[model samples]
Target chain A: MDLWVTEYQTPSLGFSCKISETLRVEQTKYQHLAVVNTDQFGKMLLLDGMIQTTEVDEFVYHEMITMVAINSHPNPKNVLIIGGGDGGTLREVVHHPLVENGTLVEIDDRVIQASKDFFPQLSLSFNNPKANVIVDDGIKFVKQHKDKFDVVIIDSTEPVGPAIQLFSKEFYTDVYNCLKADGIIIAQSESPFFNKDVIKMAYSGINNVFNTTKLYLASIPTYPSGLWSFTIGSKKHDPEKVVFSGDLDLKYYTSAIHQAAFMLPNFVKNIIT
Target chain B: MDLWVTEYQTPSLGFSCKISETLRVEQTKYQHLAVVNTDQFGKMLLLDGMIQTTEVDEFVYHEMITMVAINSHPNPKNVLIIGGGDGGTLREVVHHPLVENGTLVEIDDRVIQASKDFFPQLSLSFNNPKANVIVDDGIKFVKQHKDKFDVVIIDSTEPVGPAIQLFSKEFYTDVYNCLKADGIIIAQSESPFFNKDVIKMAYSGINNVFNTTKLYLASIPTYPSGLWSFTIGSKKHDPEKVVFSGDLDLKYYTSAIHQAAFMLPNFVKNIIT
Candidate 1:
């Protein structure tokens, strides 16, 4: 018998990977979580039937979402990540030697526990001295904290249930308030090919709250449409013009890629503007 | 009952699309060809069970493959396309006012007939005065004509069956001799994620023949990895530095995109290097 795990990207589209074994499956407080070992992608993490990360292609998403914002900021000493309980985003954040503090706020502790159990490559960062792992609602946490972080990364899932508020303009306003004068916020905007409405909402929400807003793209094979987008909202810094001179060992994020990611295709650009 | 067309990208991975109807299916002299009207991607053309192009995202592949080579050369008048039986590449070639002659050499006549019967949006370019559609072996055609064309596009299917020779070094050397002194050649070099060996082979083959060779990327969701790569071999001009000033009504290719497409992520760059 053949075992395959399929993610229905749309009602008419699906992507599947052959699985070797089911590592773990549980109903978390927020969503359905599953960890599976696949023949092609190695260990995979899924939430609410959506792929969150895979061993083969996790670098593209983690590096792109975190490094672009971290490198763009001049002095990114303090960072806050929301909803990335898998610890991939936090792993990328702590790579920079200049970063003194990295805090991750996730609503569910079950995701963190699963990552610790199955995805040790990513969850190992939780033991770092600079890392601060918190179990709390990201929205409520942002409301209480004001002007503390140099970079705020909204690493939430799709804007369906728990993440609906994360894509709203009101939530962006709170995130903007929780950042320093020259802070930068980066969020995982959905695929431009599949989620035009979500992209437009995220871009517009960021645009309304920040002085400079930019949208960039990366190709994550496990994600919907294989093309994923990131939206950056900066209070003062321009991500495109920032000079990143760091020599962090990376597989996907580079200085050239940093600038190139912001150069959207005509159809993708039309989605936001 | 529901019907789905699945492309087994790898032995362990698959991408599927819901099909409304099977418009045509035939075993051509060279390969098996099929045209299906998909609910997500509109009409899709498949050769030997691999997607060649789809109506919804065809512009991304067609524009990226042809425009980069045409714009790189200072004066591209005569252009040759190999194995693009679907006529999408020809449509993009004819869009440029500078392309006085666009000759397409496809191995199978059945593909052209199928395109004309079903995908009229792409096959309509065959009627243009500048288009010279010929059903011939591209390898034979290139050997017969030396120093004839300004741009040569190898838009063949995956490196399999009849298209296998298209990725060989000897074939690239022959193509090198078929071009003018200031000529450029572009070929659809498979996915960086899935076809690393193929990318290396195509890149090294082109590099051996041309003074300058570069690999670039685009996202075609219907393709194997959603991230697709194209290899360019230039004699005298660098594609990255090309200033495309034409106002061709394109959906994907732009001057900014022309430069940005060449910016490969570190992992993809490591493949060819």
Candidate 2:
């Protein structure tokens, strides 16, 4: 294969970067991150050997997983974000001032360290007073806690590798037990654009326990197919009509965006429903 | 090279289509039409070799471009859409009964034919009596017509290949000349993340012609970066304070999103200012 590396310069970011035939590497202090130019997804963002997000875009995946279920429950005082080492979901959650406390349950401290070193903007959310960092396995930590969190955001990596247990039915049940009544649970199931079979299985598994199950989209440039979906499950609150009183002054999240986020495209609406 | 394809099955469509790579050839409709997989963009809807919107999601991009700008303009009377061959923008535009006559000028006849054949949902808009379709060069069309349109939306593709001319400084001046005193123009500039240089050039070029210029963003999965920016140029109205009055009962476009769309990310905000 021809190694075609072209450096793209952003006016805001002074230095020019590269887009190779195999990988578009952005050199940072932590590691050499790769963005692949795929035939399907225009570009896919990768770190080390793991998929961070794909070309099709995964902001929907990060946003919906963090926002929909968590926002569904009224007055979410204390919050927990598990395994979202990248801090994208944490960035979305910290926007809500009502979120008095937000604890991140991440096993690999390296992920957070790498993100902070490379992606500073996304990692900035961790500096908030509401954030409490706990570098531990999400499964082990949730089992010990008893109804302490009003909402739990499972921003896990994927079903493969160390994140295998995160996709299991047991994880959903444990997450259900960890939240208070009228609480919500949102998990970053794999990309619905590429991993629908796994996404459907996870959707059904979560649906069995919760009264409300819904899927929504966000476009992330580094995700597969530029289309990413997140499934939300709730015990008490209806996922559709939740009174969002608190405003985070988000660039993406809004009352209209909240409602529109649930309005799945006909393609996604068909598969899971 | 290792070829991978992924599929996002739509039960509603009753066809489990091959979306991105990770999956091989799913099915072929005709001699020229074959559904191929991709690694980056999940499943893509391709005809011959060109890309239509993927089966998974198209609404996000279409809605973001149309609603945000359309809603920002106070009373969209006479509208002109340049290079929107897919008819998605026209579909969204016809939704507003306030629009007197909606004109669409697309240079590529193939895109129009492909969209009409494959995307019936989007093609349905052209049937409206309010819409007038013309096959001509958009830049030249704007140059010929002076001061006729109220809202001009340049919904063209990337600034490569045939779209190079669309990004030129001369074309923007033509757009300015084509709009009425209070009329505004919104063009989908490149991404803030990857294509910031192009974005700055576009902004600077548009600024040279129009007095009021504002750069806004939307999350588009198909674009290079999940971060996509749209530059709006106006003659009389302030891009910051353009009051929108149209109520189309849209899912994505609302008063809140109208404001949020204008909020540039901190990284993007730093450079342009």
Pick the lDDT winner: 1
Evaluated at residue B18, the lDDT of candidate 1 is 96
Scored against the true structure, residue A34 in model 1 reaches a CA lDDT of 97
Least accurate 10 contiguous residues by lDDT in model 1 chain A: A240-249
lDDT of 2: 0.67
RMSD in angstroms, candidate 2?
A: 9.6
TM-score of 2: 0.62
The parts of candidate 2 lying over 4 Å away from their true place are A1-50, A53-81, A84-137, A147-153, A159-186, A189-219, A227-273, B1-56, B116-119, B125-127, B238-256
Off by over 4 Å in 1: none
Fnat per predicted structure, each in turn: 0.84, 0.16
Clashing pairs in 1: none
lDDT of each: 0.92, 0.67
Give the C-alpha miss distance for residue B32 in model 2, angstroms: 14
lDDT by residue for model 2 over B1-273, one digit each (tens)? 443221211111011222334322233322133334433433454433334455335666677677666666777788999988778889888877677888999876666765676567778888899999998989889999998998899987667666778888999989988998888888888777667777887888888999888887665544444457888888877765537664556544555555656755345665577
Error of 2 at B98 (Å): 1.6
